[model samples]
Target: MAKLKSAVVFLIFLTSVLFQAQEREFWLIDTETQQKKIVKDSVSAVKFLDSLSKNHFIFTELKNVKKVGLRTEIYYDKGQNFNEAFVQLSDSLSSELKIEKQFYTKNLDSLKKEINKKYIDQGFAFSRIQSKYLGKQNGKQKVELTVVKDQKRLIDGFVIKGYEKVPSRFVKNIEKEFRGKKYDEKNLLAINRSLQNHTFVSLERPPQTLFTRDSTNIYLFLQKKKVNSFDGIVGFGNDKSEKFTFNGTLNLNFKNIFNGFESISLFWQRNPDRGQTFDLQTDIPYLFKSNVGVNMNLNIYRQDSTYANVKILPAVYYHLNNRQKIGLRGTFETSTVMDSLYIQGKDYSKKGIGIWYDYTEPTEIELFLYKTRIRAEADLLSTHYSKEEITAGQTRYFLLAERNFYLGGRHYLNIKGESALLNSENELSTNELLRFGGWNSMRGFNEESLFADFYYYGKAEYRYLVSNQAFFDTFLQYGELSSKALGLRPKLYSFGLGFNFFLPIGLMSFQISNGSEFGNEIRFSDTKIHWGILTRF
Candidate 1:
């Protein structure tokens, strides 16, 4: 009897444990077709039904959920109301998400994604969306979406990772453009373009964004660039006697030496005819953290014992933005004949005021300098001839524009035009006329060889990029020159080919070109050849 009781007790305990360990099975039934499918658990049944709602069955409802023994039954009404679905926004998101308060959509899943994207782009990086079905209403399925916006991020400032010595003011200028704006991809890309091929600094990599509790900060990894440069060019050509002659040019530029984005430049050139030119300019972009800045220029030109001219220009400008500026400039000029016997030139003094504008848009590729650039100035002056003792009113206008167009891969079309006019009712003297022609202007002629009262030239260049640091180009130029004193009105054309490549020392350039008047035959003896190099540090 004792053995029987022990077996019976063991049997009872085993039965109870088996009953407790039984798994619950779920069955989903479609009310219309009466088709049933078995799922492992309640969660699986709900997920399968939700997917059907995303298809044409917009009004899908879990009408009955009943548990019996170890099995559960889920009855869903997959209503065929595929026409429209309505979205109801939560109180917190009503203003932001309610353009057409009740949107019509066939798929609830896509609508949820659309709403999520809207929040993400508006600085809600940590926002979450939860959708709940509220059954069918007015022949459409109604759903409520609640947004949990964890944080809204705005740009606070910038953090420099490398090249820490980069001027603080330069970074401030960049920050001022987008600070306090929403932290999004659009603003991030704008920052990248702003720093691309910058004069003083270049990006080591794309910028990064750091998120904090209070703000979003941009982290810049930069490498300081060698923008200060020394450029020299030497030219060889035949003089009137068919003898070889040499002319040279020197330019020295210092930038950001004081860490203020300021610059100083000195330029001197000697022409084959013994004419010489010198210029000095200084620019301070910002004054005591203000937008106003100053620029000063001094120039002296001597024309081979014929005449000499001196000019001084001082100006102040306001920063319109990072890439453009407008300013007012004052001019003082004096000219004298080198020899009293030189009757073609006269002694004169001029005082003038002018408005100037400058703009630059850097190219997307570092191989090129700029995508577009413009610099223009117009001045009105009162000129007094010391010998004649007569005062005349004069107007001077100058313009330079450059644009580069990309021609598919590794090719570019660069168009450049420059024009200058010195107008007066009185006869203009040789000492006061404009001089142009050189590697910087009309490439085929000697430096400062062409003298004119008014001139305009346009250049079209085709460039093939060999590498990041090398390119080959051929250019055609055509222009007109007018000079009343010389009694000349001539149409001229020039063509040139050049190649620039980078060496260990610097960038080296070489070109050979020739120019002639409309009726003159091109001659090899008239060709001008130039060799130049630019070293930046």
Candidate 2:
């Protein structure tokens, strides 16, 4: 078996070199004036010739992998010996433009027959020819011969059928992308690739084609597919304040499940103290083929805190494309502060329904570490019958910026920041006090410290891939929340950093933070040290 394989490979190599149209010339002949016209070897470049001679020139008895190369021969009848008359015309053609490789088949009549017959097998007319030279040594009597390969005409029109689910209109629009092209049999087998590229469409079958309109048109048959899926998430956190919490969620979605043009999703999340939520959503796409998707989610939440007590929300989201997204979210929320042993009822929560318009835009930047994508979100909250956020509500102006970076090798980093401008009329809710020493922020301090009017958080992490499906991650963070705005007030800053090794099946979250200011008696309210299985999915 090994010897057979070796023989076959050698045969193929010989054929490839033999077919190369090395030292060959080409010219256009004029039948009426018997004049030879040389032309630049544009399409017949070196690569083109190598591809043509690749399998036709060699003599071999062994059969191996089907030999194939680029198509090079395109002939036309001049009604005279034009090829012969124009033999020397190739020398006068443009010298600047050169052939990458001018390859031709030599001493292989069988290969010519094989190629001409191959064209016919593909539905184009085919034929083979014989040529001989007769003339005065150099400028002899020129004669051009036409080896009649199968003759075929180009296609003019096409028809598509068997399309379901994939809007016919959309398919028709895509078809326009390939209109003035021919039915290359080789390419015909590959043309169906476009259907696979349609993100919204699921292809169930390969395309089938047939000739139409006097071989000038072809009708293609197609079939569309349907699919569906789901996602789940869970998160957990704890701190030195002896506080712990768990959050879990489930999302179910169906695409092209029934109405073909639409999809639906149901979501629910449960959290202790942090609140719980349930949402239902649906969307329709390409109603206008603008690459736009419109969806709506009905949401409800229950939480008893200083900033937000309980909430019932209904939101609509629209994604125009990758760069921008706009959403109008409304919530009927009740805010309240949990009674504490020390603070009593210092925090407050009110019930109110508010509608907000949120917009987020992301831009990419090339950074020294790697490429980073920064996203900014702005929201116009407090619509409908409601007191102005600056006048009564806590936050009137909210702005948040987040950046994600791709670290070279296996390291990945992400940074985020959020700020709010509250109206003087609205007192800061105790429950809204910026918390520290938790899973996300300053991990060294207790998780329930909201003393600051404004706070900042910075974090960094390094990851190492341990296996095809597992990795080890370590992270550190620093955060501060001051009693004054922009952290100028009596600062309750927290500084702590920790690391954890996370795995795919589960994760280990760890942290440690210090809630104190510099130049002051640095006393550790506490050092938070803990680990758990939790990684946002």
Winning candidate number (TM-score)? 1
Clashing pairs in 1: none
The sequence of per-residue lDDT tens digits that candidate 2 reaches over residues 342-408 is 3422333333333333333322221111223233333333322122333244333345555555577
How displaced is residue 44 in candidate 2, in Å?
30
For model 2, the local distance difference test gives 0.44
Q: Once superposed on the true structure, which residue ranges of model 2 sit more than 4 Å away at CA?
A: 1-308, 322-324, 337-376, 380-425, 432-459, 464-468, 478-537
Question: What's model 1's lDDT at 262?
Answer: 90
209, model 1: CA deviation in Å?
A: 2.4
Model 2: how far residue 274 lies from native, Å: 7.9
Which regions in candidate 1 have their CA more than 4 angstroms from the true location?
A: 1-115, 129-147, 165-168
CA-lDDT, candidates in order = 0.85, 0.44
TM-score of every prediction relative to native: 0.77, 0.43
